[model samples]
Target chain A: MQRYKIKISYDGTDYSGWQVQPDRVTIQQVIENAIKKITGQVVKIHGSGRTDNGVHAVAQIAHFDIETQMLPKALLRAVNCIINPDIRIISISKVSQAFHARKSAKSKEYRYFIWNGDQVTPFLYRYRTLIRQPLDVAAMKKAARQLIGRHDFSAFTANPNREVESTVRSLGMLKVTRRGQEITISASSNGFLYKMVRSLAGFLIRVGEGAVKPETATEVLNSQIRTARVPTAPAKGLFLWHVKY
Target chain B: MQRYKIKISYDGTDYSGWQVQPDRVTIQQVIENAIKKITGQVVKIHGSGRTDNGVHAVAQIAHFDIETQMLPKALLRAVNCIINPDIRIISISKVSQAFHARKSAKSKEYRYFIWNGDQVTPFLYRYRTLIRQPLDVAAMKKAARQLIGRHDFSAFTANPNREVESTVRSLGMLKVTRRGQEITISASSNGFLYKMVRSLAGFLIRVGEGAVKPETATEVLNSQIRTARVPTAPAKGLFLWHVKY
Candidate 1:
């Protein structure tokens, strides 16, 4: 069997997320089903990581095994022709059999966009959140800087039943920028716990509104309790941007 | 009564067009109904030009007389609150009573976007056309230069019943750029006849594909026959970018 690495782009509006569930429509299920129809084999495509429902991905990496040794270009075209129009196969290339999408990744990046204008733009409503009140960028930046190191992010994760004994993870970068009425928040980390990015964004928004202080992240880090963190923001405004090996 | 000029933006996928029509929803009808609900008076907004169905606008200029005196900022907020979510009022300001949206415009700018990649993106599918082909940009640019300057553009209009006395129109510029899998065409003119910009784009695409000669536009213009021109492109990929007074 030969393994293939594929780059994908999708609009997550009508999807249940990247993972395949029994009765739900997902990106993985759609693609895998299309592959089965093309190759007549039930194949499992392993993604770099799972994105929550309603979250978009500009370039999601995945790996799958094929039984036949066909040309990569033909496989790309054949798979795309069978998949629905909402999902797209951007590129495909052969990879080593041992290349695992999740284990080989060194870091991941995510971006959250907000439209901080009085009126919501019709063109941007699907991709951005409309916030009528102007956010304080300086406060958000100050609060975000405190999260740029290895620390226990237990408070920022919503999975109360998390089994991992070590909750420490290294944060590579956190940036906030305001252009006109649009605000963008980009964060990178070695690994993220479930719902961690959404909770961090929610807390940063509260800090930008002056409801919380800049050092609130430190307090949340120090406190191992999940009740100390802010609510999780909606998944529709979040995006899985890139993955680095 | 005070005359107010408003700048508007809309995603026209759900509307019939910029003008009111029977048995269909239109951008004009939706905005007018919202205005009537806000000020308790009927308003007639004169737009710069009529856009075909599924054509979007980034900055459409319009003027209307309001009997109730209100500040520009307040009017902007009030109108936005009542307008449909698909249409947005970007800016509003008081203008001279002599000003007219259609007659007082000195120039107009329009943009057409095409995605030339192998796969189409769902998020951008409604906004742009997916043209999966290798385009010759140099040839398209060479053909576009012949359209500059004052010329009778009867050959570039799709309307057979076009009754304009003089088809002489002055073009400011036309540029074609290829970025990644996208091709963008930006054109500026003092005025455009019925279906002129769409027809020009269609003709340029044919030229880019080597189906027509580079000097085909000049030949069509010299012929002065409506049947000598190419067909108008789909309205979904066209945008009224801006209007200069």
Candidate 2:
């Protein structure tokens, strides 16, 4: 069977997340159904990672096995035609047999957007978190610096059903920038735990609001218990930017 | 009575465009209802222009007169609290009694977006029109230049309910740019006839597809017949970007 790597992008507003459930519609289920319609075979798609409901993705990588003699362009067109309007198959390429979407990735980048202004813009409200208070850029930056490098990030993750061997992860970069009424936080990490990015954003927002000191992250990191030290920001503002290998 | 000019933004996907109709809910009706809830007075909003159904606006201007004494900021918050989440008031300020949202504008800009990519991005599908074919950008630009200048645009407008004094309007600029799979067309003019921008976009798209020649617009303009033009494009892809006074 030949393995194909597909670049995907989706709006998670109507989805119950990326994973398939027995009853609810999901991003994975929709794409998988489209693929089945095209190939006439029940295909299982493996995503790089899962995003929660109301989240969005610009470029998500996934891998699937299909025994086909069709050319790349033909396969791309066929899949896109079947997918129709919702999920986009940006690019499809044959990958090495040993490649795995989740395991082979070296780093992942995520962006969180905030509509920080006196009034919310209706056209962009769904895509951004509206915050009336201005964020302190310097404080957020200082707090973000503490998150870089390898550490046990148990404090930042949310409750997950699955088990993890380790809670330690390396963050390559975390930066925040503001343009007019929009504030964007971009983070690159080896991998993320469940709700890690959202929780981290919530922590930084508290720092920016002067509610917590920049060094307060160390306490949360040391204490792995789930508490009020940090709160998970809304899922609407988070986006899976890209997956790297 | 004091007249206030408010800049509004709305996602017109759920509403029946900007005007009120008996059979459908509109952005105007929603805002007016919210205003009435706050002030207990009937408020009629005058917009820069009426946008077709499913057409979005980034900075659509409107004006309403108020007889009550209330701070602008407090009034804005109160009205926003009453307005549904789908619509929002971005900013409000007192305007001269002589100012009218429609007549005070010197020029207006509209943008039409088309996703000319091989795949449809679910996140952007609602906001952009999807065209699968590879568009000829240079050819489209050459054709768009012929549309700039003052001319009678009778052939490029839809059938109107009322008679207009003149069909002639000045075209300030028309620019088409493509970045990756996204194509953006920005058109500016002193004013527009009903369905004029959509028809112009439809005409340019046909030219880009080699379905019509660049000189076809010249003939259509001189014909003074709406039947000579192509179909008007969909309203979902059009956005009233900004108004310059």
Candidate 3:
């Protein structure tokens, strides 16, 4: 059996996200079914990580094992031909069997888009989160800076009822920028918990709104509390931007 | 009766253009329906121009008369509340009763967006037209420049069946700009014929693709023939940017 790594991009709308579920349409299931039809084998494609419903991905990396003599480029064309236009196979290449999609990732980047304006443009309704209030970008940037380096990111997760093995993670970057009325918050981390990036984005947005101070990031990180962030940003504004292995 | 000038923005997807049809859903029909519901009167809204299906607008100027004591701000909010998220009334203001939306407009601006890349971004699928092949922006820009000044633009018009009063129109600006993978072509003109802007855009794109020469723009214009420009750009990429009255 040969393992192949594939980079993908998807709209994430009209999808149940990256995981498979019974009787529901999902990105993974759609691709798996297509693979099954093409390769005549029941195979699971392991994604770098799962994205919730309405969360888009630009360069999501995944891997799957198949018993086929087809070349990587041919497999890519075959898969892309059957898949819908919303989901596209960006690239495909042969990979070592030891390389797992999820475990082999060194870092992942996420981008959250916020339209801080009186009203969101109708054309941009599906892509950006509208915040009809003024936001302090400098404050948001300051707060985002504190999120860099190693910390227990329990505060920046959506799942409160469940416990994870560990919450400590190293953040490579936490960048906040305002271009016109749009505010973008991007983060790169070694690993993230469920809804971690969204929660972090929500926290920074609150800081920008003057509801919270820049110093609150340190407090939340040190607290190791699930409810510390209070709310997570909407999935529509979040995009899985990159995954570096 | 008081005439109100309204600036509107809309995502033209799922809409059958701005004009009201017998059975098809349209922006004007929806707005008129909402006005009927609010004011209990059937009123006609005169738009600056008609947009084909799937063509968006950022600042589409329109005027409608109604017998109402409600303030302009209140009217704006009320119309926004009833309309779907895809259509938004940006602003409403009192205007002279004689002000006609189409006839009184001094100039109109339209913008066309083209994603000139190997792959189009999924999130921007609905908004931009994707062209995978490389395009020469300089060639396109040079070709676009020929569109400036007064010219008989029968060649750029789509309709061959309809006889217009005059095909001569003054062009204000035809600016072609490329920012990375996205190319934006904005044109300001006294008025445009049926699909005139789109046809002009198509001509420039062909010039950029090396299918035609930059000098062909003058040839098309001077030809005084409709078939001089063959292809018309798609509606999804066109946006009615503004109207100056």
Evaluate all candidate structures by whole-model CA lDDT and list the values in order. Answer: 0.85, 0.84, 0.88
What stretches of model 2 exceed 4 Å from their correct place? A160-164, B84-86, B177-182
C-alpha lDDT (0 to 100) for residue A116 of candidate 2 = 84
Ranking by lDDT: 3, 1, 2
Q: Which CAPRI level is candidate 2?
A: medium
* TM-score for candidate 1: 0.91
lDDT of 1 by residue, A1-245 (tens): 99999988888878999999989999999999988988888899999999988889888999999898889889889988887766888899999987888999889999998788787677777778777777899999999999889888888888746846667778788898999988888989979888888888888888887888887778877886788457787787888899898
DockQ of each: 0.57, 0.65, 0.52
Error of 1 at A29 (Å): 2.5
Best candidate, lDDT-wise? 3
DockQ of 2: 0.65
- The clash numbers for all candidates, in the given order, read 0, 0, 0
The digit string of per-residue lDDT tens for model 1 on B1-245 reads 98989899999988899998898998888878877888888999899998888999999999999898877898788777777667888898899999999899999999998777786776787778777788888898988999888888888887645755778788798888899888888889978888888888888888888888888778877787777448787887899999999
* Superior candidate under TM-score, 1 versus 3: 1
Chain B TM-score for the candidates in order:
0.95, 0.95, 0.96
Q: List the residue pairs that clash in candidate 1.
A: none
Q: Arrange candidates by DockQ, descending.
A: 2, 1, 3
**Which stretches of candidate 3 lie above 4 Å from their native place?**
A35-42, A67-82, A136-152, A207-225, B39-41, B136-149, B212-223
Question: Candidate 1: misplaced stretches above 4 Å?
Answer: A82-85, A162-166, B82-85, B120-123, B164-168, B179-181, B227-229
